[model samples]
Target: MSAPERIPPRSVTSAELLAEGELTVRGRIRDASNAALFCTVAHAGQEASCVYKPVAGERPLWDFPDGTLAGREVAAYEVSEATGWGLVPPTVLRDGPYGEGMCQLWIEATQDAELLALVDEEEPGPGWKAIGFAEVGQGRTALLVHADDERLRRMAVLDAVINNADRKGGHLLPAPDGRLYGIDHGVTFNAENKLRTLLWGWAGEPLPPEAVGVLKGLRDALGEGGSLALRLAALITPAEVAATRARVEALLASGRHPEPNGEWPAIPWPPV
Candidate 1:
């Protein structure tokens, strides 16, 4: 067989390409829990790689209503955009081969990026922050640590706002352009507190000044009749939208990274 078609260089308006292009499924991303098709979208002679997850393929979750994951993913992207973080890649909700689904720009992660590490030391030393300990086969344990990078810190705050229940290490993509992108946001924006993540190194620490400014902007954007609030209301339930606004307010009031509330699992199963 001939080699699969490679995507051409993407333009600055990649989101437009994803929303209006012709999407062709190239292959299946077998590792995803849900059906994640690796595809290419072409529009106006511009082609780029993307992932399409049909709403029909989403698994039912007891906590979240079925078939809403796609919209939640889009909602997360909207929130990310409002924060001006660009933490999530360009994403859109569009009809695909199977049905309506979430389409997101596919980001290539660098192989040499060392974001998470398993160290033998008790403390995380200088540039790392501890994320509790983990078992390493033969009844031994090691500390799980992630980089003390600003990108991840922004992601943590984003996760809290979105109530991302599964911020696994694999979801983080360190792009070649030195920017970090987080994917797999299907299980986010629940009405309840379900913020599970591995980037809890800054838990309980004061929010950075930059983050505070962004939060202030978010607060305004998520208020009643605000653009974000209206966008999210259409995607998620009114209750979930209110919950999201409340979470932002709580974060601003506390001015610190959120700690595990102890009501649910702090870290996702099979972390990483």
Candidate 2:
């Protein structure tokens, strides 16, 4: 991370902070290697959300040192927007004049409501299906056991392509509208050593029409010029990208990646 681009903070005073103490924060609170505050904001005429590092933590990611967290966040946002799939909306990551940690936009999500309801009821039903991919449909919906087994495999391959380290079932939120949303992009597009998830069970398989369509749409939306390809070029090596392209093509040709081990790599423990 480096000094973020100079930009005005997206105000959310009109939307009112919804955190534990009315503080504007990112939407999801995570206590991983570090404690990050997540919240959603809509005060700036549109909904935006962001995550920031707490002043106190074990040790920040090497790339996110003084003045760099904001920069990394900005770059991450640029990449997410460049990619068509819905991402946690980006916001300006700024330094607080009073020596406080930074703040950014809140990622809007439909998971909060649905997850709470499902947890309270101890299960999900109807519109929800347990696809058994990574952080998707875990705990909230009944595991589809054999549900779309092959599609689950393709999702894994995509995770590998994106180098999405945290693709647990919970990370893939299926909105009521049926569109699956992917989030938690703290780690992506880095050219080297992109290993951190368990989504691909069918590596050599052909991508479903749904996935092919979405990927095609996203690539088209990216157009010929965008920060995506460049950022990836900078962080993700062309060789890696080429390898991924080859892998995708292979999967398309075969329609599935198979493992005889008879167990999925590390999908969410329980399909929601």
Candidate 3:
């Protein structure tokens, strides 16, 4: 069989294509912790590669309730869309071969896009921001750094709002079109503070003007009876929705990027 064709990101119908398309499982993504199927969705002659993670395949986590990861993935997409940055790819909850699951557009990362690096220098140089130090193999340690691009900064803000528990470097996808996308958001939207991530370079820094404006807009959209509030209510618990609203409010009040609360690990295990 031939390989699936790549979907063009410029398609205005991508969202519709994903929501209503016929999905065919091509293979399994072995590296993924859950049963992530690599599939192709087709609707009205339009076809796109996508990842489908059925709720039945989800592993039970002690902190998060079982069978809710798929919904949380879709919820993260909704919040990402509300941010106006489109940091997360187009995603939807739908039925597939394995039953109900979260299906998302597959983003192919550009081979040359370098978002994270381990440097022997104690501090990061220009065009880079330090994430802290990582212990390399063979009793060596190096500074872990990420690009100082605005795309990542926006993503950092989104991660905070969603209370994402996992923001590993492997989740950051830099597209060929110069757009950055983050994936694997199953462990998110908890009512508690579990915002572990590698994008903490701007921790405690003043929020950019653009970010502040976005936060204000989000605060309104997450209010009672707001469209976002209603949408999130179905995906997560009522307390989680309230917590989402509170996070936006807190960000607006502080007018700065959030710092690690120290109650939880500041970064995810196996950062990459």
Candidate 4:
């Protein structure tokens, strides 16, 4: 078995970071979604890379309107703590020309023994592929079959709180270190919207006993009585916040395990 993975914490302050990296105003990675550049820094005479996403200019994509990426990142860091899944590590958000920008946690590579076997360069799909294991005949049919269920459930609750409407298959990555990390949290905390890609494959089903306990822990940690509730209400609408709290309460009260909902589609976009 692989040892548990850990996301290294951040200690560098904003001023220290600004002083370290050269201002290489990059725009090559720019597409419709976002515009980004890397902060190139030297450590012991070695160059290290980290990405910085600047706010979009006028006539920007509505997906990240008003430069909410920085706020969303801050919120994600906080909610990730509430989930206890440890999927999101520390990240940095800084000021930019038009709006707030962000310094994100960079992923070095994808490392999964099972996924490597399924790789086929000929038809490596649209997203990142696992090429190293294609020669070896080893892969699993389903994603995260061996994942810690309790941890997944905790993550689900965190998604609920954040209103993460886009938990797509690609967003979940299995690291070489045997840990799961969730990325792309720009579409969260709208209050009225909670569209999802995964987790609700089985909706309206009772959560497992162990999952229930974890939710209980999450709720207790997030807040009790009306204190935490008020805080969330301020960020999200009253009705939406209440509904979320109720869902948590319902999970804690029920004993049945989760089941397939068989109603909603995987992605909100129309099938191509």
User: How many Å off is the CA of 226 in candidate 4?
Assistant: 9.1
Write down the lDDT of every candidate, Cα atoms only. Answer: 0.93, 0.43, 0.93, 0.51
TM of each candidate vs. truth: 0.94, 0.48, 0.94, 0.59
Candidate 4, superposed: residue stretches over 4 Å from native: 1-32, 40-48, 57-67, 96-99, 111-154, 201-205, 221-247, 250-272
Better of 3 and 4 by lDDT: 3
Question: 193-246, model 1: which lDDT tens digit per residue?
Answer: 999999999999999999999999989998989999998887888888889999
Q: 17-67, model 2: which lDDT tens digit per residue?
A: 222122355344654444466644444344545555543432556632223
Better of 2 and 3 by lDDT: 3
Q: How big is the RMSD of model 1?
A: 6.1
RMSD of each: 6.1, 10.5, 6.0, 10.7
Instruction: State the weakest 10-residue window (summed lDDT) of model 3.
Output: 7-16
Per-residue error for 15 in candidate 4, Å, reads: 14
Q: What TM-score quantifies how close candidate 4 is to the native fold?
A: 0.59
Off by over 4 Å in 2: 1-30, 39-50, 53-83, 87-157, 190-198, 209-227, 231-272
Candidate 4 C-alpha lDDT tens digits along 50-89: 5566655323436434336545655566556555567764
